[model samples]
Target: MWVEVLGWIIVIVLFAVGMAGTIYPILPGAVAIYAAFFVYGFMISFSPFGWVFWTLQTLIVALLFIADHAVNAWGVKRFGGSKASIVGSTIGLIIGPFVIPAFGLIIGPFAGAVLGELYARSSLEQSLKVGFGSLVGLFTSVVAKIVLQLLMIVLFIIWLLV
Candidate 1:
């Protein structure tokens, strides 16, 4: 009984962190959620997580990786950004939190896109437009990830119960 209680606590906390990770790139949110599932099933009984379920989970992880990059790249391209802009945005994303914790995530991509476009000899106005696109893409990704993570958690709960 005590072991089960402790497991629940760990799983809950990890899930919460995973949800937060969807918005904050600093955390491995999706993986954390997947870990929670693994921990729960392992500590209790792997009977619940069959091979089919594990396969789907693995595919979801892959999808997350593909989506993250695709959305960002699409955003840059749709807004007339070049490869340099994408690279810059990626760099900014990695560096943002470290440089400015409060708003680095928001500012990093925008600034990076702008700088990247400028480097490519784009006009200031064009650079700014690309920055806005980056911002849109960032927010869209965050929302999409949040929904996906929630759905994953709900699915796990269903699997556990049923």
Candidate 2:
């Protein structure tokens, strides 16, 4: 009984963190939730988490990765940004957090997109539009991840209970 209680606690905490990771990239997001479900299944009985569960979870994870990049690139392109803008946005996303704390995440992508567009010889106004598009993509990605993450958690819980 005690072990089961502890397991529940662990699962809940991980789920919370995992969901948080949707927007706060450092947390773990989909992977964390997937891991949590696995751990819980192991602790209880892997029999409940059969191939179907695995397949669905795996697919969702794959989609998460694909959507993350695709959406971002789409945002850039939608705003008339070039390949450079996409590349720059990616670079900024990687380096922004290290250079600036709270705001770096937002600034990095925007600046990167703008700089990338500028490099491509786009006008300043166009560059700004690309930067804004990058931000839209970021937010959209976050929302999508959050929904998918939630779906994963709910699926696990349903399976566990059923």
Candidate 3:
């Protein structure tokens, strides 16, 4: 009983951290949440859900993980970003957490977009727009992840209670 409570606490903490990480680039936000669910499910003996549920959940997680990267690349593509831009934006995202505080996450992607657009079109204004668009795309994904996390939590609760 105590172990189960401890596990729950750990999972909850990870979930919260993942929530913040979803915005920031340093942390593997959705991955952390996905891991938490997998842990919780297995720890609870996979009681309510059968093999099918676990398999489907795992597949969904894999797709979301891939989507995280693909969506950003798509954002850059939409703005006519070059190969360098895509690569640079990825680097910027990595550097973002260290360079800036709260705003770094938001700024890094835009900076990357700017770098990408500049390389592709040689236009500062257009690059800025592309960067902004990428930021919007990232924000949208984060919101979606939050919604999914909430739904997952509710499902877990329902499974446990009923």
Candidate 4:
């Protein structure tokens, strides 16, 4: 009984942290969530949700990981940004949080995209447009991640209850 209780506690904590990680770039949010779920299911011997369900959830996590990058790149390309701009945006994402805390995440990509466009000989207006596009893409990605994460949680709940 004590071991089971401890497991639940750990799972809950991991789920909470994992959800938070989805928003922050530094943490592996999806992976954490998946881990928590995996642990719980393993503890129960996958009684409620079997291998098929587990596999589905795993695929969702994998897709989320890929989608993050694909969507970001799609946004850059959709906004008329060149390869250089995409590279710059990626760099900014990595450097932003460390440089300026919360706001850095938002500003870093925009600035990076603009600089990249400029480097590619784009006019100031065009560079700004690309930057704006990158920002929009980032926002879209966040929304998608949040929704997907919620879905994952809801699925877990349903499986547990059923």
Candidate 5:
């Protein structure tokens, strides 16, 4: 029916946006994708994908959410960043989007980590290293999210076809 076609179109759009969000950090990327799936499943009465698929997707989203933070912290620590640097990076992530928009998200964490290291009385060279580490961590996390998102999409498509 026309309604079903409309639903598919809306879901696809949302999925695309969600995938982009994973890269940009502007939107809840994985969450948005999951929401689309949830809506689709609901519309179809969960007949095919059913509760098991929903549960699997939910777990994937939760794991990715936790991993994002863990990976970032790990990156900072791996680079010998102090506790202050970690705190600074967190603050940068929160404020970057608002301060500089798209690019700010990328720059904010590095700047924040550097500033934090400086505040902790580290040498300038060491602070820069910490900042670089923070940047690396952010990049790693984004890549991980993208891979996971792709897997989710693939699963959705396979389920749809079957």
Candidate 6:
């Protein structure tokens, strides 16, 4: 009993941490949520809906992670950014974790696109356009992930309540 209770607490904490990870580049938010669900389901012995559900959830999370990165790159490319801008965006994303809280998340991607464009072609106007495109793509990706998280939460709640 105590172990189950402990599991619940740990899972909740991990879920929050994972969500935060989604914002920061270093952590995997969806994975955290999936892990929490996985653990809780195991503790309760909720039958087939338990582990199988979470395994599928984990797969979706993984797909979203990949899709997000790809879309962001595509967005930059759509605006004529070269390989340099893409590389810069990646660097900016990595650097974002260390700087100003949530702001870094936005700035990092934008800076990366701009820097990438500047390096690739030395054109300020084109760089700005690429940055803007990248920003839009990033925003869309965030929305999609958030929606996915919400769906997972809803499914968990429904299963638990029903």
On residues 49-105, what C-alpha lDDT tens digit does candidate 1 reach at each position? 787777877777777877787888788889999999998888888789789999999
Please report how far candidate 1 places residue 149 from its true position, in Å: 1.0
Alpha carbon lDDT at 16, candidate 3: 82
List candidate 5 segments past 4 Å from native: none
For candidate 1, give the lDDT: 0.85
TM-score between candidate 5 and the true structure: 0.92
Q: Which structure is stronger by TM-score: 3 or 5?
A: 5
Give the distance in Å from residue 162's predicted Cα in candidate 4 to where it truly belongs.
1.0
Best by lDDT, which number? Answer: 2
Native-structure RMSD, model 4: 1.5
| Lowest lDDT 10-residue stretch of candidate 1 | 41-50
Better of 2 and 6 by lDDT: 2
lDDT of 4 at 70: 79
The superposed Cα distance between candidate 3 and the true structure at residue 53, in angstroms, equals 2.4
| All candidates: TM-score | 0.95, 0.93, 0.84, 0.92, 0.92, 0.84
Model 6 gets an lDDT of 0.77
lDDT, candidate 4, residue 117? 90
What is the lDDT of every predicted structure here? 0.85, 0.89, 0.72, 0.83, 0.86, 0.77
lDDT score, candidate 4: 0.83
Angstrom error at residue 31, model 2: 0.7
Q: What is the lDDT of residue 54 in candidate 2?
A: 94
| Cα distance off (Å), candidate 2, residue 78 | 0.6
Which stretches of candidate 3 lie above 4 Å from their native place?
A: 41-44
Per-residue error for 135 in candidate 2, Å, reads 0.6
What lDDT tens digits, residue by residue, belong to model 3 across residues 1-162? 876787788788878877777677677676777677766766655667766555656665676677777777777777667677777677777787689887777778789878876877668877776786677667766776666656555655676677
For residues 19-133, write the lDDT of model 2, one tens digit per residue: 8888677677888888888778766668888889999999999999899889989999999999999999989877887799889789999999999999999999999999999
Error of 5 at 42 (Å): 2.6
Candidate that scores best on TM-score: 1
Q: In terms of TM-score, which candidate is stronger, 1 or 2?
A: 1
